[model samples]
Every structure is written in structure tokens, then in C-alpha cells.
Target: MKNKSIFLLVLTLFVIALAACSASGAESSSSESNASESNANSNSNEVIDIVWYPNESGNDMKASRDEIGAIITEVTGKEVEHHLTTDYAIAIETLINNNADLAFMGAVGYVEAKNGNDAIEPVVVPSGASGTLDDAIYHSWLAVDVDKQDDFKVDGEFSLDTLVDKRMSFVSNSSTSGFVVPTSTIIDYFADSSDYGDLTPEDLMEGGSLFSQVLFGNSHQGSAVNLINGNADVAAFCDNCVENYVEAADGEENTVGTVYRVKEGAAEPFNNVIGEEFILISVTPVLNAPIAANLEVLGEEDFKKIQDALASDATANNEEVFVPEDSDASGLFYKTDQERFIPVEDAWFNPIRELSN
Candidate 1:
């Protein structure tokens, strides 16, 4: 009987040990699961990195970029890293490839990027002086040196009919105001002519077809410099893009016959061309440029924040993003009583897209 008691007691102890072991295993599993959940929460809370790509036009506006960047950081709580580019294609590609979170580009560039990747969306665009999209535009000018302006005039008025076989300098084939708008105007105007009925934008890209020679300045400032330096008989650029460096020398501002001369103390490309004047032969209004974002990279929530921040009244009056005419601050936007950034829809650019078709 004593031997039986000893065996039963030993069995009882074994059972206790088995229960303890099972509880320990369960506790370990619970601890590991909690740890994994903690790690996931930490990862989710981590800040996302944002990259901004700017068109070549903004390459020289560092102070303006910093102010804009600060606003973005304030809204997102993430610092923005700028990727400066010298070509429109580079900025467009960067945004389409998801390598950049944001981009500042014209309607053409934004449309192209959206075509490459539908994930791109327009965040905001600077409004006209009246704070309305109806006049939210910039001018595309077909200009010639002051000395050659008379050669482009007919019957005492400026005309594009004399542009045939003239040497031309275009900012970039991808440029909206510099190339797309101006080229579309040329194609439309000459489509009714018997000899040039088959003319296409491609035909004007090379020297032998219509122009004596074709040169791409790669930037608005560069295109204006090309004309002033005698590299091309005529050139295409935007009014506002060169506003900081040029002022009206003859006629009215933005008028087709107006002549603009480089400011005396203008920056780089314009420094040597100072005092040189270019007369506008053609002036066409184009849609305002937009600040575009990659929806996939920014996500809907974060993108909304950025879009709202940019369109806020505070940003409009910041003076740094939209510099006042009298202010010495250099900025991407020019300030007026009602000028501000406004949210835009993708369908708004359909008109620009139609020009290509």
C-alpha cells in the first residue's frame, strides 16, 4: 500500500509539472504576439519622406523654394527634399515614376505625366490677379529683336505670315507656352495655306522644313537669351517667366507690339543681354501652371493636407510664395490683391490636351 501511495504521489507531481510547462508556453506566445504588434505600431507612426521636383524655371529661386518647403513641412510635419532639374522632361519623369512626391509644372507637363501614370493629380494652381480661373493665364510671345521687328511686320502691323523660313529659338519642345501653344498657333494659322496644309509641329522642329534653323534654349530665360544674342531670328518664351529681368521699353506691357528690355542688373543669362530689347510679334494666353502631386506616393489623406495648405489664404499672403511687385523678395508667384493658389480639377486641362490632338 505504501509503495502504491509513493507511485500515485509521483504521478501527481508529473501532472503539475505538465500544466506549468503548458502555461509557460502560452505566456511566451502571448508575449511574442504583443511584441510584434508593438513593432507594427511603431512602424506605422514613422514619418514618410517626401521629395519635391521643380521645373527648370524655379531652379534659380532658392529663397522662394525654401519658403514653400517650410509651408509644406508645417502641414505634413515632414521635411521636403527638393530635386532641382534643368529640363522639363526630367521633372515630369520623376513625378510619373513615383520618384518624386510633388512637382511644379505647366499644364503640358502635368498632362504628360498623367498620361504616363494616371496616379498623378493636380493639387493647386496660382490664380490670376482677379483670383479667378477665367483669367488664370500667362502669355506666350513670339518675339524678335527690336532691330528685326520691322521685318516681321506687314502693312504697318505685326504678323506671323513673315515667320516662314525664319530661324527660331524655342524654349523646349515640352514647354507649354514656349513651344506647345506657339506651335499650335502656327499650325492652325497655316493649315489653310495651300503650300503648308500638311504642316505639323514635327515639321517645324527641324531646320529644312519651315525654319532656316531650329534651336532649343531648354528654358524660358535661355530662349530669350538666344534671341538677344542673335542665335535665332525669333524666339518663344513667357511674359511672367522673364518679368523679373525685363521691363517694358516700348508700347504696352504684354501687347503684341510691345518691346521689352532686360533690366540693368538682371541675373545670369540676362546680364549680358541687359539693355537689349525684344518685340512681341504674337501673344497668346495659356493656362496657369499647376503644382501636381503623385497620388500613389502621397496617399489621399496627406495629399489633401498639402493641397489645402497651399490653397489657404495664409499662403496667398505669405509674400514669399507670392511676392509683391514692390517687395524685393524673389518668388515663383507674383502677388496682387486677389492673386492666390486655388484647387483645380484634372478635367480643367482638357483644352490644353486638345491642342495636341
Candidate 2:
């Protein structure tokens, strides 16, 4: 009878020990799950800093930058710190130094950044139409002042040869549409001698070379203004810039300048033209700038979050941010219209890289 009692006591002890071990395991699992949840919540609330290139400066853009920051915050569920760059070179520098997580850069800036530092990746590009991102190209124009339109005529037809020995203005030496493409076109067109085959980019910029005097107005708007004010006889600028200037004219009788078409053997030449209207002297297919991310600093998961957020319907449907408007509070990009941010790879900008080279 004593042995039977001992067996029962041993069995009771075994059951108690088993229950205790099971409870301990359940408690450990619960604690691990709670810790994971806490960490996730903490990460979701982290703020992300983004740098914006002040391609356009004013009180209007400052307000728009704030609004864009808010949109990125809401869409990505992370805080946003927006840094406005002073110039194009500074914008790329910020990314290279890892001072900023992302930047909105022109095609030339993108190429410069990619070449300078190999730690960047192009995230997205603004879409102008319903097509591939590669087709989202803009045109550049060589504009002449309204008063000097007759000076560029040859037998009453448009002639680029007339631009030789004329004072000219350009947006910037590194500018894609305003300087690079247009300058390359001019160099090729004016390559008459053996030296033309070996002319350097710096040669084109020198006074009394391709032009009598070369002036960089620093910005496209500034270049246009330089032409209007007679600081230059001709200006290298963008196609959209002319439209913006004319729209802001408020129907003034005296117009600003005219964009001319380049005659390079077209059967129907773009004739002598001047005024608010654009006559394409040379049209360059230029891709709109892109927003790139620093891959070394941003993780894959977070990068995916930002990419998804930017391409979301929320951003696309937000008219105030996507569409351009005249008001200061109307947002920064595509304010007059809506643009969808499409995903792009680094290879997408290879064409631009080649062009720059």
C-alpha cells in the first residue's frame, strides 16, 4: 500500500512539472512577440530627411517644399525633413556626402552624382505623358531678342551661322537643356575647319570663339531675362521657359523674345520668326530630372516603402501637390498639371550619360 501511494505522488509531481514547463515556454513566446511589435511601432514613426534642389527659388517654392514634405510623411508613415539646396552642384554634393537621404536632381546632376559617387540609385522620374519614362523628354530653344530677329536672317531664312560673333546668354554651363544639348548642337553645326573636329567644351564657352561674348545667367529664367534686357543678343534656354514668360506678360504690347527653329537641311525651313511664339531652331529630346536615393544609407525595406509611397494613388490624386497653380500654397511640382512618378532604374538615364559624355 505504501508503494502504491509513492507511485501516485511521483505521477502527480510529473504532471505539475510538465505544466510548469509549458507555461514557461508560452510566456517566453508572448514576450518575444510583444518586443517585436514594439520595435516595429518604433521604426514606423522614424523621420526621413529629403533634400530638394531649388530648381526654382522664391517664397512660393519654400511653401511648396513644406507641403511636399507633409505628403511624403503622410504617404510613407514617417516624419520628413526637407532640405533645400542653394544650387545644382550643392544638391548632388548633399547626396554624395550622405547629408541627405534623397534628392531631386536634373539629368546632368544625376549623371554627375552617379559618376562622383557610386552609392546612388535613381528611384523615380516624372512622367509627362502616357508612355515610358524614357520618353518624358523636354525640348530646349535658342531664343533671340525681339528687336534682333532680323540679325539672324540669311536670305530671309533662319540661319544659325548668323549667331557667330554675337553676344549670347545661357542658363548654366552644366545645364542639360539650356547649355549641354544646345551647345553641342552649335559646335557640330559650326564645325567648318580642322579645329572644329577637336573643339573642346571650354572653347565653345570662350569669348570670340563660337560667340562674341558668352554669359551664363545662372538660371533659365535669368537667361531669358538677360536677353529681354539686352544683356545678350541671343539666349540658350528651355522651351517651357518661353511659355512661362509669355503667359506672365499680362498682354503687354511689347513682347519679351522669340524662340527660333534651327535649319539643318529640312525641306521646309523654320523661317525668320520672333516674339512670344517659339520657333524651334534646334529641338533636343531631354528627360525631365529624377529623384534619387542614397543606397548606402537607405535600407531595402525603407527604399521600397518610399518607392511605393511616391507611386501611390494618394500622391497622384492629390491635385494640390501634383498640379501647378499660381498660388504660393499650391505645392511644388507639376502644379499646372498632374504628373505620375514612375519607377526607373539607373539604366534609364544611360542615354543622358552618353549625351553628357
Candidate 3:
């Protein structure tokens, strides 16, 4: 009986040791599984960086950008960080430096980026129409307040030549529609004109020599505002901008300015003649602003993913992403007023680059 008790105690000790060994092995396996899962989650949650230049200000701009970022996060399954540049040059530089994976830029900005770094390429363009991206064109206008119509018009006809001794507001010198296009138009106009046929932009813009004074409004909207308030006699502006200003006038009659419309027959700015549109005048050839990606930062697979997200069927129909907060759709970014995004190639903007040069 004594020997039996000793054997039973030995058996119990062995059983406890075996159980402990099994428990430890199971714990080790579980730890490895958890580590593997953590690694995967970390990889999936990588962040994407984006940037844009806000041509306009207000809370609505922030709201729109946030909503777009949310959509991108949902589509790409990655965290998205967005930065708004202080100016057009900064926006271009953001892409050139590869600080931003993607950027929304005007043709002129894109041109600058392309010249600075060939790695930048256009990925998508906003379609103003549901039909095609090619339809997404905007205009540049030369406008004067109603109070100054007599100072510009001769016998009910608007004259571009009258602009020579007036106070003028121009959007940013870097602006495509506001400055580049309008200046190109003006240069072409005088270059081919009978009266000032031999003139050049340098001769025209010599510090109050082009007009009595030249003011930089710094924005399309700001240019329109300056013209409406009588701070300027003629303003280099855009089509959508003037419409928004008129609407903001709140039923005030005659707030509509006399706009210089570009005649279609102009061979170049030289052939361009001014007509009185009473609000918006000549249309600069439409500029299709684009969102581009830096090839060095965004892999081909990831670039395609970003493109798919913006062009996705679901995004096109999302009112929160595309719809304007106000009745003036033209005042909104995307200016398509929520139209779908379409694929675009770099060549599409080459004409703009040539014109800008």
C-alpha cells in the first residue's frame, strides 16, 4: 500500500507538467497570430497625402474638401490628408516637390509643374457636363461697371482700345483665365490691330502705362468685386465670376457690368475684337483644370486606384460631393456643379501651355 501511494504521486506530477507545457505552447501560437494581424492592419492603413489651392474662401470650401477626402478614404481604404495651398505657385510646387500625392491645379499651374518636374501627370478632369470632359471649359472676361459704360462704349459699341487709359483690375498674374488668357487676348488684339498694331505687352503694361493703373485682385472673384464697387474701370475676370457677383447684388438693378466678349472670328488676340455683352464679354478658349498625380510618389496601381475612386459611378451621383451649396453653380469648384469625372491625358493641356508661353 505504501508503494502504491508513491507511484500515484509520481503520475500526478507528470500530468501537471504535461498540462503546463501544452498551455505555454498554445499561448505562443496565439501571440504569433496577433502579431501577424497587427502587421496587416498597419499595412492597410497607410496614409495618402493630397493638396489643392483654394481660389475662393469660406466654410463651404472646407466642407467640400472634407467630403471629397472621405470618399477617397472609403474607396482606397487608406487615411487621407489634405492641404490647401496659399497660392497657385504653392499648389504647383506641392506637386513638383512630391509633397503631395495628388493636386488640383489649373492648366497654367500644371504647365509650371510639368516644366519643373516631368514626373507630374494629369489623372482626371472634372466634366462640367454629364456627356464628356471636353465640355468642361470656362471663360475669361473684360468687364466694366455700369457707371463706366459711357467711358468704354462708342455709339452703343464696346471698344477694347478704350481700355488704354482706365483703371483695370486683373486677377493673379498666374491665373489662366484671369490673366494669361486675357493678356494673351489683349496682346494678340494689339499685335494685329490697325491703330496699335505694332504694340507689345511690355509696352502696354509698364506700371500704369498699359492703363491709368493696374491692380492685382489676386482672385477671379476679387476682380469682379473690385469692378462692381467702382475700384476699377475695367477688370480682367472670368464668366462664372461676373454671374456670381451679379447674383450677390441682391436684387440691385444695373449691378450688371459691361463685359467685353471675345468675338469668335479673331485669328489670334490680334483678330479678337470686343463686343458689349452687358455682363460677360469674350470667352477665352476653355481651360480644363485637372487633378494630377506625382509618379514618383504614387505607384501606377495606386494612381489608377485614385482615378477609379473619383470616376466611380457612386461618386458621380453623390450629391454631397458634387452639388453646390448655393444656387450659383458656376461659383463652385468643379464648376461642373457635380458632374462626373473623366479621364484626361497630358496632351489635352498642351495648347494651354503653348498659349501661356
The per-model lDDT (C-alpha) reads 0.73, 0.57, 0.58
Residue range 1-357, candidate 1, lDDT tens digits:
222213323333333221100000000000111111112221122232223332333545776766777777676776565566667777778778766677788888889999999999988888889876656778889999888878998999987789888999998788888898888888777777898768788988888777889998888888888999999999999987888889999899888888898888887778877798889998877778888988877778877877777787787777778899887655678886788887877877766776655
lDDT order, best first, reads 1, 3, 2
Task: Tell me the deviation in Å of residue 106 in model 3.
Answer: 1.1
> Model 1: clashing residue pairs?
none
lDDT of 3: 0.58
- Tell me the tens digit of each residue's lDDT in model 2 across 1-357: 322212323333333221100000000000111111112222223655566554444334555455556655554566666665446566677777666667776777888888877888877676655423433656676767544667877887667788878898887776777777677667666566563555556776767666789898766766766776677888877754333234322222222233333222211111222233333344445666777887766656667666766666566655544654454232445544445666676766665665576
Residue 343 alpha-carbon offset, candidate 3, angstroms: 1.1
TM-score of 1: 0.85
The clash numbers for all candidates, in the given order, read 0, 11, 9
The residue pairs found clashing in candidate 3 are: 188-269, 188-270, 189-269, 189-270, 260-281, 260-282, 261-281, 261-282, 262-282
Q: Candidate 2, 308: how far from true, in Å?
A: 1.3
Best by TM-score: 1
Q: In model 2, where is the ten-residue run with the lowest total lDDT?
A: 21-30
lDDT of 2: 0.57
